[model samples]
Target: METPTRTPTAPPAFADVLVVGAGPAGSACAQLLARQGLRTVLVDQHDFPREKVCGDGLIPDSHAAFRRLGVYDEVAASAQPVQHVRCVGARGGHVDVPGTMSVLPRRQLDHILVRAAQQAGAELHTPLRFEAPLVEGERVVGARLQGPEGQPPVEVRASWVVLATGAVPQALTAAGLCDRRTPTGTAVRAYVRHAELAREITQLQVIWHGRLRGGYGWVFPGPDGVFNIGTGVIGSHSLEGGKGRRRGRNLREMFEDFCEVYPPAARLMREGEVLGPLKGAPLRCSLRGVSGEHWGRPGLLVAGDAAGTTYAFSGEGIGKAMESGMLAAEALLHARTQTPAQADAQVLQAYAAALRQLQPQFVLYERAGIVNDWPWLADLLIWRARKSPRILRRMAGVLDETQNPARLFTLSGVTKLLFE
Candidate 1:
């Protein structure tokens, strides 16, 4: 159900910035803005500590964001330290690439961000679904929210409206901001609680198998003897053959095949108890879907998955999502002193410029995502990585983003792997 366009009977609430969806992006944005003394309001359809489907792998980028946000110790306290990413290939050749990484369930990680935002003086409003953006003469002034039951519609007016909703296209579509209705990809994950499973999976494990045509599987060891195991395919029915290069099976078949194909997953399902039903979520990636104009409109800015910040090859979103949110916060803060129209112009230009700074990296990731279709490439890379210390170092560099993956996964690179 949708809230009507008519003005609300109650008095309108105001804030300096209003953020929708309290995921990592929204909460991170709100916290940074609030920390800078802006009257920020963060709203979400659900409450904190709710379930969120994710691989939950916090790589180096995530660590950098946590430190910049000044909550690394708080968030890392609940995380399980992971040293390497065990990349298993289709032909069984594998390598344990070293990195600074950890896995923390989204249930815990998101709550930490929300609490951090609140601690920074941002007002947290939950159980309020965002209906539409409140626009004043084509510039978004705030949002129209639909509260529970017959609690009456609430109009929140702000100088800026930030849409940080992850992957779900409904909010963007409702606000007439969606260019692509379907997500570029989809993923499913489930939590399993077993001491042996968690103990065995010390590294962030990922398997690339032939059975999974346009995707791969992962088994991340989370905190307190819990593991998050999942698979992500680049295409669904509607998204088939677009970036995936081929169509993939349904999420059910994908999960089943992943469990049956990977030894770790097979053991996880056979011995450990699945904590809950398998949860599925969409992934918007490669910076494709939304246009640059939509990324930052007058008085409106999008961050996280809503702005396609997730990496294509690795399926890592947490770090990039937080980065984009922080960037949006920086943009708004930089332009806070200008007049309404002038501020909107400056912020929009700043967001656009900021996204451009990150575009080259996303393009490289998309280029490397071709390995999903040809699992043999992973086998070759792993095989070479095992033989040469240089290759292994390059693999580790890719994890830390100190080296470009495009340089590691190309025809010339493959030739060097064979000859060197």
Candidate 2:
């Protein structure tokens, strides 16, 4: 792939929808919009095949989303299917959760999606640094971008601007569209190539151990003897003595400590080589709520991370991101048929309503504090289930999101936890 070069003269072109960020969210939105015969342009700060810091695991819902987007075959071809998940507790007790999932290196997965968007007729520009939103009256008209070569910045004017910028909501906040909040968690992860355990454990595993109070370690397997291992802690609990940066233990150190306790993992580490840097990214537990008031202001709409569609428990953002992206595209298409102000309101409302309706369970789960506010409860459940095969199976169903938590916890095997 060629790095986008800045020309002395800006390209004189316009698009119906300008998508910022070419990751899964932006690519998905761009693909859907372009397929609908809308002129779409997808922009990213990095070139194709660039590495993204992630666990690289795709859940069953993600697979379903891929199918909906007509890219399931492509994703399946590039990824290794992960059939089961194992959760290990701090006490060395572990529970195996059987489920259908897949693991793909982010580099390969991201490139495939970008290409898919391009094939769907979306114009893709990469290595283009996003400057700021171009505002016309009270609405966002488009965006300003500068290429890596230091040439004059180019302006992209569009009927709608979709912000799919992941994780960091800075761009949206900077434009006075969203308020920024401190991330509630931080994680560090790195890829390792180990041949031995790669042969022994073909299933994905999430191991929780260490002094880190509210976090767990994970080992997600990928193709070619590769695995992603990492640890994360709730930011609030990670702080030491209520002080400075040095007060908290870094996730890398916690992961190293975990490896010391797990003999099998230790053996793999001694034999394995790091494939990349110990990458870290913030995990936002709470985002400025996704509201229609700020979502669609004239010509701008937000989707994916920029729209706070991330799950609080597993930090699974990709599936929600793709869902939001597709919904945004549909909303934009709806908007095109109406007058400007009316169109904006209709598009924004449609996007927001679709999200709320599609994931009503998530909203309920969020309210119940399934992942965030109940770490100890989660740990106890994992520990108990590990000792009972039948209970483990029930736990697996819950983790798979196939059964509701209320139903899963009602099982006689799991109800023992209440008595205990």
Candidate 3:
């Protein structure tokens, strides 16, 4: 993908709808809206084909969503297939979950999605920094933007504004539609090139230990001979007191230590060539009222990371982020046909209902995250899962989201694991 042509033409004064940030969420939302002839304008501070810090692993659900967007083929052209996921417990129990995933760097994935949005009739604006939302009496009606220096700032008015500005959430914060302090988690990743591992590694591997029970380290296949290696830990993980809590290193320090001490990961990494400096980012786990609200005041909607769509345990959010954007577009398209006085209320209500359906699962994942803080339990479960195909299927279900996460916490489930 080449750099998107930066527009030097004068900016439009208004649009039917304004989308902030051109990542997965923003681009997906704009594509749907514009395809419906909504005169959408999608803006981002960075140009296309740019680097984004991510795991670059798209789970099965992400493929499903991409197919819905008609870009799965394009993604597949540049992606590597992942056939399974392997989990290693600190107690030396290993369980492999069979599934399918795709690995595509965000630099390529984001560009493809943005191009799709433009093809669907959304106006693309690059290098346009979002300043704030255009609000009136607590209602967000549009957005204010600052272009390159030396040019005057521009105000683009619209009937509605959608904030998809990712984890940092500049648009959501500027509108004052949510919390002053966004709760967040952190993750760091590095690129490693191991010729043998690259050839033999057809699955995604995660290492879980008693020391860093709250978080896990991963090795996912990347293009060519590269492997995307990373570790993640939520801020609240440090506050949880459990058997796994032994007072060890910080996240970055843990990553360094993990590369040295964790045999499965360390062995492969030791034989690999380091490609780039480690990159890290704060993750917003869609904590309602803490990160930001999904349905805000009239004429405003927050999708993707800005709306806290990321799952808690695995931190795999690409699918959920795009899912939220698609839902928002559906609700907004419906609202557009309604009377002006009723549109905002109606859209908010519909979007809220859609979000409500996902709340239970999110809460369940949060519980799983807490449970993961206890490595002994994970060790037991993985060991049990290795013996029973039934348990193994259930465990794999949790990762792929095919089953309710609450099932893992049920009395029957625990009894079956221990004695069955």
Q: Which candidate has the top score in lDDT?
A: 1
Whole-model lDDT values for every prediction:
0.85, 0.72, 0.79
lDDT (10s digit) by residue, model 2, range 279-379? 88765543333334545566777777677665554656677778778888888887788998789788878876886674655653344333333334556
In candidate 2, the residue pairs with backbone N, CA or C atoms under 3 Å apart (3 or more residues apart, or in different chains) clash, namely: none
Q: How many pairs collide in each candidate, listed in order?
A: 0, 0, 1
For candidate 2, which ten residues in a row score worst on lDDT? 2-11
Order of candidates by TM-score, top first? 1, 3, 2
In TM-score terms, which candidate is top?
A: 1
Please identify model 1 stretches exceeding 4 Å from their true place. Answer: 1-12, 237-248, 292-294
Using lDDT, rank the candidates from best to worst.
1, 3, 2
TM-score of each: 0.94, 0.87, 0.92
Please identify which of the two predictions, 2 or 3, would achieve the higher TM-score against the true structure: 3
Question: Which ten-residue region of model 3 has the weakest summed lDDT?
Answer: 286-295
lDDT of 3: 0.79
